[model samples]
Target: MSSRRQYQREFVRTFFTSPTAVEGDDSAKMLRSASQLRGMQAPDAWIPDNEDATAPSMREEGVENIVEVVSEHGEEFPGEIHPRIVWHRDDPSTRYEGFQQMLRIADPEAGAVEHVDGFVIPEVGDIDDWKKADEFFTIIESEHGLEEGSLSMSVIVESGAAELALGDLREEMGNPSNNLERLFMLVDGEVDYTKDMRAMTPTGELPAWPELRHNTSRGASAAGLIAVDGPYDDIRNVEGYHARMEENRAKGMIGIWSLTPGQVVEANEGPLPPETERWLLDVGGSEVELDDVEGGQAYDGTELGLEELDEGMYRLEDGGEIHELDEEQLRERLVEMVSYVPSMDDIVDSMAEFEAAKEAGRGAIAMTQSATLVVDGIEVEISTDRMWDEATYQAAGTPIALFRDVHEHRPDQHDELKERYGPEVVERALDLDV
Candidate 1:
């Protein structure tokens, strides 16, 4: 396949199991995660940790972890070995360390070498971070013999500043070799909740739901990056885990991450699957019924072969007439199709099946958009691409909390904000509103 098509296709929907590099075999942990899950949808890739928090020896220990992983679980967990580079804002300057980390991976004679399929830069918030990312691409393509497109790169959205600067960061991606495909918003992990967000759940759900929704859907999607949901901390909370995964999936997140062996299955199956026996349809209200509804719905909620429906626009009953309807007519009459309730065991199986279909390129339900958010008490509209709808962001009751969070955490960057969106708008939201 050509590069462009392959690029868009492979990155769309894939779970990543991030095993701690300092301790056990991360890849093996991921394999176990997949195996335990009913669908057993093996992960698309395994990203080993190299950040200060997880691994002991930094990037070198991470590479060693991958080598051991390939040695022990080569046949079973043959996903890509992508190491994360440190880019924490609190650090004086960690972006430069990212380059060093890449060098450590590329330096085969130095002996910390492993197959470096890709890289993930954590806590990326500014233009300098983008420049550092670009430089990494240049070194891999120029010094090491590799096509930039032949590899995939990811960036984590961890800070309020990163959340706010997503647009500027996107425009900076003029370089084709950047290949910064995955944009994971950190839902959990060593996050300073007081600064970046207000919630701190061990489950995959966000502390601040509205902000999380905007970042995962608007900023990440609009930036042409696949949005990955973060890990759920408490591995024992299976019910909470399922709920969090379902919530993120509803918001257009392609996948979530796993830290331990047990989280693998539920982590991979972020949301439960599309009920094979059920029909999915939108509706005017929660109380919508099928009686007077047009053909956009299933007849009486009985299980019909997916082939029985023409893309959910009409029905194909055994001897019934083709109840065809146009898009406009379908829209006019469409009502929420009641979801089939799945038992606990059924959920386990369905999550796996849903994961399989998504991997096979047949899954991925559409996501809905947020209506409004209270940012510093003012309402801000979140755009479809998942970025702040700037024109209407300052609307009444839309809270520009992310903006305030950025301003509060990093006051030095206020000048940059003033320069980008003008001093008046930034000041009004930050100073007067709050």
Candidate 2:
């Protein structure tokens, strides 16, 4: 083969092949070692430090950081002391204690704090109760500045009624007098837009909300800033990060803040690219020009419309309608899981006993009759049955003994029962609704 062709083949084999053949030659190792020695002999073996002091300084001055906020879908609170609407299942004390723990970092004193910000689901079924809850928060924000530097409260936005009245929520947040510096919208269960659909704060996906930073003005964009909780803590890709930061800057999001220095590093990673120092010099305007260098359209800029922002991630927006999958969809997903039969004879016997209990008119007996049919580790109660009918079994949604009846112990009685119930008795038994 030609020398150039061989080189090309070797290069392709190294990267494209699943596994490349190792060269039998050992001379390369010696040559590489000698080269390393040559390098060590040279006095200029040095590591490089590439840290930028300017961008962070600029951000510190006032530029907002772009944060993609998130929170666990099911849990309340991402372990922070931001605002939230708390609800309880017959117990408000637990929710109150949770807020107290979250605010422990703030050195919260129990008695000095005047009012507990919470609301009860009115028994009259009137949704005015939710309005009352929101009003309570407005009252707290209006009053708390005199005593403590901050107010911490939770509002539970979980119910059909609350979901419908989400507009009431948006209006409260929109109110200029209501100084809700940090608002947390806690969604517990399915909320209807008509009753209680509130925009999520600390916002990103459903539960991950950016902390709502309050602005002095109450115009359309008054709720201008959102701070993501638990800021980034890793700095693996500084260049890609700064590029995103420049994108966010263009999008009108201002400075980024982290509670910990570690998070600051993570947040800085993307905004501060690998060649950020050089790129900063290259772009060298009032704001970094990430789009010009990379040659792709800038991350959705401020000039772009909200419909364009939809192409990115879905976030909680005030006065917008959000729809989740219906119960049928949820059930369909659950039914997709695999179902397997068990292999325990003792469980089968126990289930048989339980079946006997049912035939005896003892209502429902709990026992292990078969490995497949079990309750709390005990099997089905149908003792004499074997090899259940797969089609009829699944259609019935319950287990029926394949062969014998409860009176198998008394063959004569078993025959009589079969005559009365007929061959389809097992099917009838299976038809009993769980």
Q: Rate the local accuracy (lDDT) of all candidates.
A: 0.47, 0.26
| Per-prediction TM-score to the true structure, in the order listed | 0.53, 0.24
For candidate 1, give the lDDT of residue 76: 38
Query: What are the per-residue Cα lDDT tens digits for candidate 2 across 1-434?
Result: 00100000000000000000113353122112212221112111000000011122232111011000111110111111121222233345633432332232122132212222221222111235533444444444344332321332223334444334433444565455544332322222222222344655454334322211111011113323121111122345555445434443333232232322233334322221122111111111233222322332232233211121233322211124332333343223212321223322322333444555556776543322211211122211122233433333342232222122122211323433445445454344433332
Error of 2 at 162 (Å): 12
Q: Candidate 1 lDDT, tens digit per residue, 83-198?
A: 66676655645766767767656553443233445567777656566555756756765565555444456666676666666666566656564544333232323254334666
Which numbered prediction scores highest in lDDT against the true structure?
Answer: 1
Error of 2 at 283 (Å): 15
In model 1, the runs with Cα more than 4 Å from the true position are: 1-41, 52-59, 67-78, 90-93, 107-115, 175-190, 197-206, 270-272, 278-434
Cα RMSD for candidates in order: 19.1, 34.4
Give candidate 1's total backbone clashes. Answer: 22
